[model samples]
Target: MMLQFEGVVATGSAALDSGIGHTALKTLNDVTYLYSVTGPGGGIAVWKLVEGALPQLQDTEYFSGTITFQVGGIGMPATLAGDDQLVLDVRTATGLIGYDLNPDGTVGPLQETGTLTGGGDISALVQFGDILTIAHESTGQIATYTVNGDGTLSLSASIAGQADSMQVLQAGADHFVIAADATTGTISTYNVDQNTGALTVVDNSDALATLGIASPTAVEVVQAYGQSWVVVAGAGSNSLSVMELAGDGRLIPTDHVLDSLHTRFETVQDLAVIESDGHVFVVAGGGDDGVSLFTLTPGGQLVHQDSFADTIHSGLQNVETLSVAHVGDELQILVGAQQDEGLTQLSVSIADLGIVRDGFGTVTGTAQNDMLSGSILETTLMGGAGDDILNAGIGATTMHGGAGADIFVMQYGSDPTTINGFQAGTDRLDLFDYPLLRTPGQLMFIATEQGAQIKFLDEVIVINSSTGGPLTSAEVFGAGFGGPDHIPVDFGDFGGLEPGSSDGVQGTVTVASEAANPGLSDAEIRFTPDGGGTISVRADDEGRFDLGLPSGTFEGELEIIKTYSTASYEITALDALQVLRMSVGLDPTWGPATPENLIAADITRDGMVNALDALAILQIAVGLPTAHEAEWVFLDDDTDLSGITENNVSYETGVDVTVVDNVISTDMTSILLGNLEPV
Candidate 1:
């Protein structure tokens, strides 16, 4: 029993949204997709396109609580891989990263993994053999994460940043993922290491080989003969290039087919290519919305056989994302009609997927300029050469303005609370029109991960501030620094408190004060140095601050009072002996002061210029002393530039600094042993 898209009638549900990232998978086992058309008034809708023909959507109830990133950069959804296993991306929950998603769709806590500066927009995803690689549109970070046996994932490596699209193809044992960068307008190649999931840059400046590939949007690979071929689509140049992939994972451009040459379509973004019955079919749809078929030589060269031209648009509806399949008996082409805000499926018996009707004209909207907000694709609503209103994404969205000095509006949040989260009613509205959307209360900033846009909208008015305009707020804190000194304000949960060796993961850590210090009654938890330090603390009823530093290593302190009478006050630290050997558990302090304080001669882990100070120096060089221990006691002498070898010591070629005395030298070393600062 084969089920296909017979027709699309209406939508289903228009309220709280839920989406499984990337493509929606519909199996043969009766599960259909329904669109829920939405309006401004928060009107509810439930228009079933398939009616009772499809199984109802499963209730995503248990997945409620803190809204954390649900999917990651590896083999996710479990449906994407084996039923017993799933791979997820490194994330930051609380303060930790490396958040894996379970088959039950639950977050697998936090763990530190590899470093990935950018994690947004994983449109280009694939496992180039061993490494699960994804190309990000936000930062062009070509990151690869390895899937662990426990279904967890670790960030392996990421180099290429802000790539438009990616596709993995194999030739012999070597594998490569073709990456088309949106920013550079070039086709880059990556060689993936199967063992470590590492990505090595193959070639990014291969644009010289390509003919008209200006800013590619889609890339697909087909195996013809023993060679693999890459089909690159350009939304900018309105062209498609056919490149050859050698077994070594290098791209060799053989030829290209420009849309201008066919005089059919102007731009191409979404497309699919398949090899069927000894013929290679390339369906180039979306943007101009058309398809093209071709024949390939055994040597990986594309010879265009036939192509469908122009837009067979259903009225003014625009098809943004397109997916084609040569499955079962018929060729299915599913088009995501973006502007139409619906999904249109057309099953062509190898003919309808071709050209149906031409004469698809364009809409020359009002002679006066209109407005547009949110994000824009490669080829999108051209403002018809007028002074149009454009509200590009928070980042610098590519706007042609088409010879018109268009007025663009971009906004983001400046206040700190905005960095955390928006308050109630905080509408993250993407203003369709510039002037109308530029009503002030919006803040715009650069995206830390992806290079796209970021606009922080405070539609909720949730911040605990009393002043400021529409994008301005006092703070998320109540009375104290981060919050009130009395009330227990929420700052969310702690992330991965222990990530052993994962690169990208930075976990959460909370410090609880011991039995209560006697000299710390009026203390206040403040990230000290106040100006920009990361450490903070708040005492118990008796006065003890609990500092929760997300990052593993940090060095900063809080205060005992709301306002310190004296800037410098001695606070008791764990005994230097006990603090140093934190590796071995310390015995309980029965009363006070013990011989542990007088362990041995203070071993300064820094430079001691005096020749007579060799014994103390030997202990430090061999990794002696604790962070809270030891000090140098010496006066006025040139710190020798000496190096100790397996044989002896030779002071030569030293760092540029003047060590007046052992005390100064020791202090300098302590500063070098910097405390963990909040990231």
Candidate 2:
């Protein structure tokens, strides 16, 4: 699991008056709206999730001018309504204010639709279906209102209760409400009549006596491991309590209890559950500097996972509320701090929870022989120990097999899939959807440099081999077929081909530079196999070397390192020029040869060194015009002759007397430049 701090956004009045007290999230048509109450003159400020290089925020609206009162809580629809209307209901000091959310996630002007009498102090608000429930802390009453089509609310029913916080849950056709009282330290449960919208008291539990839930501040209902559990946070005791909800709306306390001694739950204020990939995570925020994380186990136990604290931005003050929203494949946690006057966003990855997100669903496997399938989104399937059968759908997939032999079933028209740790002669590939056996011409098994390519119509399935050997038709296509619609192919001894054999590729490499004619010797070369592993060899004294590699199509990089200089070359087995050779004189021999050995021997740089070099040397020796236009003219001066002279030199002097002597002479110019050859 990885945690990324995505900075913070300030939310308060221009006078630096108050802090952000509450937060809520609403996702509509792939767009998410984060609503926060910015203290005194800070009405409701809406932030929209904008997709960019990273998930960012755009302030859509701030309703402080329209509603000139303090807002305590805000609520939005969990799922989309049939009319496709985006509405937000906010709890204020006077009454409930309703606003319509525009397509861009911004809110319109506030409309005072519903008003509460007798010292209205709304502490919490939640919307379930078309019913908006408001918890009035000062009046000690729970009120339910009907949401009109025009984003207005009308009073429907009122029930007597003392609740500082509230949450709603629906089981089957029954609607239940759970409320927590900070004064009495009691948790009350009620069943709402679906027809009349009347609340019926079901049961109550003394949280202070059994679970030490003193001054319960917030309550949330989370579904985990095929059961519904109610989680509560207490401010006075600074603890968390987990209770199982029975069918009759009875709260049963679980053994798992999160206290301040174990977690940073000081003055716990709010609780939110993030459900993803078959895992349930509870996020709690309070006077503590950071947010605490806990995962619900299969046995209904709350296991503390980790905690995130931004002490610089959100100190150990009243870090009141938190909410989570899913944007695309990312899960973002939004924290609102009362003292910090800002909102902190955190990105979370649940891979450490052993849960892999695949498209719209999550698929997991066991250690024994198991069967796994794909989903609408990209999927990851892991075969643990025993032989398993894995099936891929239309989505892209990544499959890996552990110890035992495994089988993979690939569907037609599906996205390309990658197979890792596929053992040749053991595992098999099933082309069940394509029916390659019935119509053999529809599929072509083309041998590629990486391994083998199974071409089906417009799609290509690449089989990467570890030994860098090409897979033969006989080694891939099954010998005996059980049916025509499904072909079970086995890669028998596909990657088992030995080097230097008939199924092996042999190539020679040579290195050269302008400073050294023959080439740089003892240069180290490295070849990285496309499938896996690496092979290394060194150049000989003559800068020439030979290597034998597995015959399969190879696709990877070749690196050459000598002295202080280094170079790299991309090579593939499909190239016609398999003989890898390089020289400073030629453009580089990555293909078949044209001039062969003499191509790189052009030392005079005239494209070719022929009789022209000899003619230039003769002209220099006789003090005539020379065509040699290189750095130094040969045989022009005594120093040039002395520098060119390597093996033989002779000088004779006669003293003014004439004498007849027989002498044999050899021209030094012919010996020095006549033997020049092209590389």
Measured by lDDT, the strongest candidate is: 2
**lDDT at position 428, candidate 1:** 26
RMSD of each candidate? Answer: 25.2, 29.7
- lDDT tens string, model 2, 1-679? 2346676765445422246666777666777877765544445566776542233445545556544454444444332233333233333446544565566666655544446642336666666788767777767788776766764556778888877678888754677889888887767787876666678888554422546667898898877555678888878877777777756675656533444433556788888877776767787878777777765544344545457766674443567778877565556777777666567777675433333223213466666555565643466787777565566645566676566656666655466766555566766666645523343345687876656777765445667654556765445555522121221111111222211201101112222221221222544434443332333444444444332232234444344433311121111221111111222222234432233222212223454433344344344334465454212111111223232111122221111111112111111111111112222
Shift in Å, residue 413, candidate 2: 51
Runs of candidate 2 with Cα error greater than 4 angstroms are 11-18, 50-55, 60-66, 73-95, 114-121, 148-154, 206-208, 260-262, 313-317, 351-679
Clashing pairs in 2: 359-377, 449-553, 469-552, 470-552, 600-679, 601-678, 601-679, 602-679
Name the lDDT of candidate 2.
Answer: 0.53
Counting clashing residue pairs in each candidate, in order, gives: 61, 8
How many collisions between residues are there in candidate 1? 61
TM-scores, all models, native as reference: 0.40, 0.49
